[model samples]
Every structure is written in C-alpha cells, then in structure tokens.
Target: MCNDEDTIKELTVGRRVGFYKVRGQIGCGNFSKVNLAVHALTKDKVAIKIMDKMRLDLQTQWMLSREIFNMESLYHPNLLQLYEVLETPSRLYLVLEFAGGGDLHTRISSGGKLSDQESKIVFAQILSAVKYMHENNIIHRDMKAENVLYTTNSCIKVADFGFSKRVNNRNQALDTFCDVWAMGVLLFFIVTGTFPFHADTVAKLRQSVLEGAYVLPTWVSAPCQRLIRGNLRSDAHWTRCWVASGSHTTASPTLTPATPPSPPICVAWQME
Candidate 1:
C-alpha cells in the first residue's frame, strides 16, 4: 500500500511499492510519475506509471480507463505489455513491461532517418500490433513516433493506448483510423528524418490532422503512399511505410537530441 502522508520528494528512489520496488526514475509528469521498478522477488525490471487523481478531471479519467480497457482486451508481442494495475485513494498505478531502448522518438531524434531495412522491420512489428488490436475491436487513435517504443531486443512495442477507439465497421472514421493516420505520420518521420505534420502550436496541429491536408514533400518514395492508403481500415493489414501525413523524404541532415511532444490527451498520441 502507498502512504498518503508521504510527500513526493520523500519517496525514496528504491522504496518498495506493492509487488514491485522502485529502482529509479524513468519518466516524470506534472500529475504523475513513472519509475523503473523491479519485481520484489523475481527482480525483473518493470515500468511503473502512476496517475494522480488530484490532477485529473472526469474526461481525463475516462481516457485512462479506456486505455487500460483496450490494453486488457488485446495481446501482442509488438504491443507494450501491461502486467498489472494498482489503485490507491489518491492515485492509479500501472505496472508495464520495461523497454530500455526507450520511445522511438528518442532514437529517431538522435539517429536521424533509419535505413530502409530498419524502417521495414519496425513497420512490420507495428503492423502486427495494429492488426491484433483491430481483430479484438480496438483502434489506436493516437499513433506516432513518440508513442512507438522498442524492446531491448529491437522489436517494436507500440506504447500508449489512451486515444485508442473501437470500431464495428470499416466505413467509420473512429480514433483507430486516426491512429493509422498517426502511424503514417510516424513513418514519415522515420523515413524522412523530420516531423511530417509541421506546426508551431497544438491548435494548429490539431487543425491539420482533422483537415487531412497533409502534402508529401519531395523524396518520398511511391511505395510509401501505398502503405498509408492501404491500412486505414479494420480489414486492412498493417503493412508498408505510410506517407499520408507528410513526405517520406527529408533533406540530409545530422541528428541531435530532439524535444518531442507529449502524448495527446483523450488521445494517446505523441510525435518525435
């Protein structure tokens, strides 16, 4: 059990919490925090995400609930594994698989565009995960490079399902297809070495996404187009690198550490 009287600063870096013991800080947020934790007995590493009730509203609460629901309903290797959840009077806890490689956005920002084979391998795993989610009636509404993470084995682990939606038919434009659009955006970043959806502010970015006015810049390959257009439906297989949101080509540039956007609220989306 968590102690209500324990202030955030007083929380030790290695204190035991429930089945897992805190190892160190892995992530931090305004309302909550994530820690690199370990299974008490097994000593296995895990990522613990804590959501603060005090900082959340009813709508945010709903998003968190839906994300957990979607994760509970599906299983796939490429999808981030959610092992257990613990609730406290003041917070909600999620114990998830540890991906030490970190979010894909981090890798792309420092490494620039990945090679075609690397892109293919990564895309394949994402496709598999998306296909599995679709089969189980789930849609990943906010798919993006930052939301896409990787395991230590270099396999894909699509993270963050907060924005995912459920669809009964192919014709509807639910959050799931929006995730597909986000996926296309991510692929554009991976292949092109830049964010496909360029905007100076959040409101503008949202407008661009809703309008679907994404235009490809020069350097995007023809096959990239096929990838984006083919998989925006429930029946479609998640294959190929999509170029729907932006061009897959970017000017040759060196990479530095890049600052990424936060995950989309009510929509678990993020960009590198």
Candidate 2:
C-alpha cells in the first residue's frame, strides 16, 4: 500500500512531472493511474501513466520492464507511441501518445452497435496492427476492445503491452493463435456490440469460450458471419488462413497502411 505522502503526490494535479504539466486524472487501473498532460516546450498533449513503485511487486516490475522494452522497440501507426520514460524514488512515469477519441469499449457501449461499414473500417486497422505484431514476433496476449483506442479521426491505436511478449521466432509463437481468437471476439463485439460468449461465472465463461458457442443475429451479413466463424474455429491453421483471405475480401478498401508519425523528442528526468 502507498503511504500518505505517496498518495498525496499521486492525487495532486497541475504539478509538473518531467517536461510535462500534469492535468486531471483520465484513467486508472489496479496499480497505476493515467493523467492527461501537455509538453511544456512543444505544447503537445500526452498521456502520462503514473505507477507507484511501492505497489509494484517483483513480478509486476518484470512485466513493466517487458512492456517498456516491447513498446520502445515497436514503430507502427496503429500501435501506441511511447515517447519517454521517467523514474523516481517512489513513482515511475511513461509518456505516451494521447488518443482523444476514447477506447473501443466506450464507443460501442455508448453508441450501440456499429454499422457493417464502420465495423469493417475499425476491424481493418486492428487486423493490420495485429498482423504487424505477429510478423515482428510479438504476441499481444491481451487483445480486447478495451485495449483498442481511437484517435480524433477514428483511427485505431492498439495499446496496453503489459501482457505482450516477444518470442524468438514467429513460427514458434503458437500464442499468435490466441491473438487470432481475440480478433474473432473483437470482431463480434464491433458488429454486435456484445461479447460472443456470456456466462454469469468465471468457470462458465471459460467453458463458453472453450466451446466456441455463440449465435449471430439474423441482421448480420453472410460474409461477416463467415469471417467471424472462421476466426473462432478450433483449428488454428485454418483460422489463420481464413483471416488472411477474409481480411482482403472484407476490409481491403480501408486496409491501407497508416502513415507513420514523426518521432518525438525522447527525454528522461529523475525527481529528487
């Protein structure tokens, strides 16, 4: 648990942290909170993830280090950009690109289900990003709607690398199949605005997912239903082929690569 002083420091707003002036809290998780901040010099908006050092156990520390290393090594338009890393005696901060349009979960929850074209547009970006990660031997173990962010222009930005892993070889990374499964789940959520699997308990949920049982509404298009079914199949080999073929036929028009943004100035500061 964080002490009184540490808690105070975290809750305080408008204070400067490194090169950015912190603002109101935007989001929070179990051990860390994200704040919206602006760079003092360039005035660019950024999300600063503040983590309490005391709250991070050894396992969490290793995961944090892996997340940072994986993020720093990646350069993709659909992936979140990590601009800087800062460390202090009591806290650690990660300066990241800010996505003003909120996350996929919130969008779906607020606006109801997306139309066929809209779902294709969003899923295409996610497919491109996941394809890139697999090609680079990185597996995003967690690929839910919540981890998918949108920019002001509605472009997809996959974030949260805490569960990501870099394998030695792309072929050896069977976990990529799990990512394929997640893509199926995400696609279902995008079009239907609901999870494919539903259960009141964790065990039942696991069983539901494992059984791969879900019904598509009659309003869903035939091609879209086929794509979702292919992705959620038990055979990993067939699922991969289906994704490759279906992505082209379904979302080809909007599957064009996003232009990479200019690199940000990287800097680090230690607090006394």
Candidate 3:
C-alpha cells in the first residue's frame, strides 16, 4: 500500500532491480536505501544501493557516477567489489558484494574487543587495500569502522568511496591523512573497544579530533600502543610520518600466511 506521501510503505519485496530481485530493505541513509537482493540468473546474493535520482542534485549525481567508476576500476581482495550498475530514468542501482558479517563496528560492539590476532588480521587487510589505493592515486577520504566490512571468510573488506578522490600525486600533502587518522581510530577500537576521541556532541567530538585530545588506556600493550600512537601522531606532514620507515614487514608471527604483511606505508598524523 502507498502512504499519504504517495510512496509505497515498503518497496515490493520481489521487485526487480536490474538483474537482481530485491528480497528486502537492509539499510537506509539520507539520500539512498540498500536492498538485499539476489541475482535473477546466477542466484548470487548481493547488496544493491538504490538512489532516487529525483531527490539528487546534478552534482550529487556526478559524485555517484564517480564513486561507481572508482569502484569498478579498483580490484583488491580487501576492497568491497562492485559488480554492476543499473541506471533508470528515476533511480540508480549499484550491485555490491554482500558482506554477511556486517561492518567492523557492529562486530566490535557485539563481540567486545578483538583478540590481538584478529586485530592484526584486520589491520593488515585494510592497510594492504589502502596502500593499493594510494599506489593507484585514489584517496579514500572516508575511512571509519562503519566502512570496514567482514566477509564470510573472516577477511575484512574496505567499503564506501563516496568521499574518495583521485589525485595526481600522493606526496606533497594530501587529504588522505584523514584516512590514516581514521585507520588509527579503528586500530584503537579493535584493541580497546572504544574510540580514542569521544564527546557527547558532534561539535565537541570534532573539537577533540582537531585538538588531538585523547587518552590511551594503561592496559594496552606497548607495541599496539606504539602502532596506534604512531599513526595518531600530531605531524604536519602526515603522509611522511610513518615510523619504521613506512615499512609493511611488521606482521606478527601470529598472523596467518594468507594475511598480507603489516601496513608498510605511512599511516598518518592527526586530522584537523
């Protein structure tokens, strides 16, 4: 049934979005909604991000196209894979890999602090993905726990590129530092089950982040603390601040053979 607003109370469960059949709504955001869907021919489960074109400005539409193009061009095991795009007169649909394990935030919230091995695994995967992106000159401006998804194989996939941008050079100062800062925050959460900077209000949280005001728990191990603090340092040239000479060979012996070497590149300094 349609509501007074003339919108359906819920999108038809079996409605087709491109070659996928929508099973149900899985998530929603300010300008879009995501549906759990399955391939009509292959029966493969996927997540489809549906955005109503009528509600979007031309610039927003351009951004969406850019995101799709970026995702389509990039391929890494640790990055969420985008399969197809279906653009209609009224809407745009993006077929993406369905992460059955949800996001890292949900896992951290429900399972408590991650074991050291788990932390190492996740950190390794994300760093590998980010390093690849950097090598390709793509900066994932948005990197947070909510954007890191876990797969059925216990591997993490870096998701979301709405804020991503391509640059001519990664050196000479770049906004990718924000990504590094967020990675540091994710590392802190994995070890401590909480953010390094927290406040009741968004304004206060922004202030805390800008001022680099945060406390590290006494219980965290020295190596872990060093890793976190090294990335979360206060440096003007964040891209050049990674300790150990921006090496990725720091993987602990506990990490599995399948895991990528520890983040060898520079993580970055605090954000403004």
Q: Top lDDT: which candidate number?
A: 2
Instruction: Give the CA lDDT, 0 to 100, for residue 87 in model 2.
Output: 72
The local distance difference test score of each candidate is 0.66, 0.80, 0.74
TM-score of 1: 0.72
Off by over 4 Å in 2: 1-14, 241-254, 257-272
Q: Can you write out model 2's per-residue Cα lDDT over 1-272, one digit (the tens) per residue?
A: 33466644644434988678999999999999999999889999999999999999999999999999999988887899999987766788899999988999999999998876667667777777788888778889999999999874457789999999999965677778888999989999999999999999999999988898789998887777777887888898876665444343442323443334322111111111
Compute the lDDT of residue 216 as modeled in candidate 2. 93
Worst 10 residues of 2 by lDDT: 263-272
The TM-scores of all predictions, comma-separated, are 0.72, 0.85, 0.82
Q: Report the Cα lDDT for candidate 3.
A: 0.74
Which TM-score value belongs to model 2? 0.85
Model 2, residue 160: distance off in Å is 0.5
Candidates by TM-score, descending order? 2, 3, 1
Candidate 1 vs candidate 3: the TM-score winner is 3
* lDDT for each residue of candidate 1 in 94-127, tens digit (9 for 90 to 100): 8998888778888889988887656765765666
Q: How high a TM-score does candidate 3 get?
A: 0.82
Could you give candidate 3's per-residue lDDT for residues 48-123 as a string of tens digits? 9988879998888788878988898899878999998766556677889988778999988998988865676678
